[model samples]
Each structure stands twice: as C-alpha cells, then as structure tokens.
Target: MPVEWVIDQIKAPDQSGAFSYASGAAPFCEIRLWPNRSLPARGFVFFIAATAVMLALPLIAVLGSPVWWGLLPFILGTLALTWFLLRKSYRDGAMEERLKLWSDRIEVTRIEPNQPETSWSANPYWLRLALHPNAGPVENYITLRGEDREIELGAFLSPDERTDLYNALESRLIAVQARK
Candidate 1:
C-alpha cells in the first residue's frame, strides 16, 4: 500500500468531535495519509550490490578478451541505468496525497517530488467518493467530487489498493456526515 489513508480525532476543547484524515503526506503534527514503501533504501542497496556482484562474476573470466571491451560498456551501462532508475524511484517515493476531513470541510493536498503542494476542498456534506472500476486511465480509479470540483484521490495506488481506499473513504465520509 504505497498510498495510505489515516483518520484521527481532534481532541482540543474547541475542536471536540472534529475528525481529520491525514492521507498522503500531512505533517505528523496531526495525522497523515502517507505512502507505504514496498522497498526500503537499505534493501534497494543490498539488491543492487548483489546484482552487481553477480553480473561481474562472468565478466571476471573474460577479462582482457577483445570481446570484453564491447561487453564492458553494456555491463556498466546496464548497472548505471539500474542505479539511475532506483535512485529516481527513491526520490519520488516521498510524493503523497494528504486529505483532511473535518466536520464542515474536506481538503486534499498533494505533494510531489520537487513540486509545489496542490490542494482542493469541498464541503464534507457534499463530497462524494467515486470509484470507476473500468474508467479513467487505470482500473479501479478513485476520485472525489465536491459541489463544483473533482479530483483523483490516489492515482499512485494499485487497483486493489484503490478499492480498499474507496471502501474506507465511503465509510468514513458517512460516519462524519452522521455525526455532523
């Protein structure tokens, strides 16, 4: 679940009964919906190291062979490409969609790698969580609709994850509406 959603209750005397959902990357000062990374940095390093060692083994026997010159670039290029992609993935891993739901309003904020934060808001009473199992660019795409706007919720999540998110959001919104 690289995309995550969490609900928290506001506990201050003035804001009693207010509910918040920190989805994506909201500051932990409250709660946040954040990414559940499938690969850790350490694991990535270990895997790359193992791969490099394995790839180097056969090449060691071919050292100084005329073919080695041609093979060397391909080997180094492949490793370099792998390292670049892995580093890029790690760099983008911090991207998140933060959704905050309170009694009166629902706000969604997105933070992407090296990008400015973008946000959308709607009244909780009028907000809708929609799941299009066959529509959009991906399967089980999820979107949120407000009175005058609509936005995708978790495009980074897998289809199964989007389904889970849809169910949780449907329930949470209903609960918040009821309490309001």
Candidate 2:
C-alpha cells in the first residue's frame, strides 16, 4: 500500500527532523530521510581512462615478438583490478535512505551491496537527527544518524544541493525537537 502518511513538507537545515502528516489519516507512522552525494566526474573519467589503458597494454606489448603475448596476464590483471576499484567507488557514491518509527526499534539498510544492516532505537521523547561528515580524499558523504543507527545520505547530490539538504534537515530537526 502507498505510505499512509506522506511527508509533504520538510523543514530545512537540521540534519534530522519530523515529517508532518499530509493526509491526517494516521498518527505519525514513520520518518524517512535521504542524504545525497555526487560522484566526481573527474574521478569517473580517470577510472575509465585507466581501464582503457590497461585493456590496451596487451596489444601494445605484443607488437615486438611472440613472447610479447605473455603480457595478456598483466592486461587481465589490470582489468580486474580496475573493475574492483570502480565498483567500490560507485558504491561509495550511492546514497542511503532510512525509515523508522519512534515508538519501536529502527532498522537501517546500507543500500550498498555487501554492506551490513543496522538496528537501533531512540528515546521516544528526545529523538534527534545528526549528520556525520566524511572528508575522503576523493569524495565526501553525509551520514544521517537518529537514536540508534545512521545511514549515509547526499552521496549523489551536487554541492549546492547538499548544502540545501543539510539546511533543510537542520531546520526540521530543530522544529521537531522543540515540540516536546
């Protein structure tokens, strides 16, 4: 079934907050948040270029002699390594969305292949949202944390969008916290 209570309006700035019930059909059922971060185009281009270079090495090495065919192993190895690195980088750039209820335990899914799942709960009265920033050499990610668990969001958002989302989340969190 469609979500019984859809979030129509979200407050800004705070990393965490509450969603108002648009239909009023049910008491607050669940809270959902998505943080996004975008992959650097330059990084992707670099990966592609590296892969192409690796794929061409065998042909290049074969130009001189029959023994040059031995370079096939090196080319295959390079291709495999490149694929692994690219997959890991893409997974790192993926955004994670979370849903939970204050009245019960929460479960967080990483949304990335081979990642572990998390579960936790917050004090019903003092539920708060938090943002954990990651400053990696190649990229950045924003993690959204609630009472017990957190998920990374904004992994695919542009810089401006990330800022806007952070603001929106911050404001919403403040408003919710002020309610009780």
Candidate 3:
C-alpha cells in the first residue's frame, strides 16, 4: 500500500511544556499517502535498454546499407520520445498527500509536482469523513468535510484502498476525539 504512517508516536511534553514534533502536543499522528509507482528507477533503466535493443535488432539486417541511415533517425527519435514520456510519467507520479492529526486539530496537505501545495485543517470535533460508493468521481471516493470546506482524500487510490482509508480515517478520528 502507498499509505504510510510517517509519525504515530505519543511523546510527552518537555519540562517546559513544549512538544517535540510540530506545533502540537503529545499523541500526534501523521499519515503520508501517494499513488503507486509500478516502475522503479532500475526497472525504468532496464525497460529503456530492452526497448533500445529491440529497436536496434531490426536494423542489424540493414547495417551496411543506405537504408539503415534512412531509418536510424526515426528509430532514435522513437526511443527519445519513449524516454521523454516515461520521465514525464515519473514526474507526475511524484505527488503526495500528508495528513496530520492532533488531539484538537486535523490537517491534510497535498503536494504535487510543479504545483502549489494545498492544505486543509479543522478541529477534530467538527471534521467528518464522507465515503461515496458510486456517486463520486471515483468509486469508493473519500472526502473530509471541515467547518468551512470539503476536501477529497486519496482520490488516486483504488476503490478498495479508498474504502480502507475511509475506515482507517474514521477510526483515527474516533481515537483523536477520545484523547480530549
């Protein structure tokens, strides 16, 4: 799963009554989520190498002929285009969402490649998780409704993952509320 529990520790305040993590007290939870990357860096290299080999295999028969020169530019262009597209995909997949929960507040921050970061937060008491099975843009869509706005959560996740996240968020919200 791409969902990770970045911080799930409960640390007591220092002697002066200050928390060590962010601007919150003890018992804070932070969750980081991202879309799955099916291709790793090594896999990317292997794929490009295999593609180049395959593309070159057909040119071997024409190695010493004028036809090889005529087709070489097209083959190189195709390989370059493929590399460019895959690199773009990797960049697009760099998006991530971080959700932080405190005893009194909950915040969700989204960071996407080449885009401004967006954040939403509200008191845990007033937050609500809404799960739409079929009516949302995606099946099993999850959204958090705050006092003033509603923001989507894990929209890039699969339907099953979104359902699991909804349940997990509900339980976490309950736990946060109980700590008060």
- Which candidate tops lDDT? 3
- The best candidate by TM-score is 3
Q: Over 4 Å off in model 1, which ranges?
A: 3-6, 9-31, 34-36
- How would you order the candidates by lDDT, starting with the best? 3, 1, 2
- What lDDT score is found at residue 164 in candidate 1? 82
lDDT of 3: 0.84
Clash pairs (backbone) in predicted model 3:
none
> How would the candidate models be sorted by TM-score, starting from the highest?
3, 1, 2
> Candidate 2 lDDT, tens digit per residue, 1-180?
111123423322232333323322322234344433244668767867877786886587567777666776777787778778877866764535454332222333334446665444444345444443446321434555556555555455555555555565555455454453
47-93 in candidate 1: lDDT tens per residue?
88988998788788889998888788888888899999988887877
State TM-scores per candidate.
0.79, 0.47, 0.89
Better of 1 and 2 by TM-score: 1
* Model 3, total clashes: 0
Question: Local distance difference test, per candidate?
Answer: 0.73, 0.49, 0.84
Output the worst ten-in-a-row residue range by lDDT, candidate 3: 12-21
Question: Model 2: which ten-residue window has the lowest total lDDT?
Answer: 1-10
Return the lDDT, model 3, position 93: 94
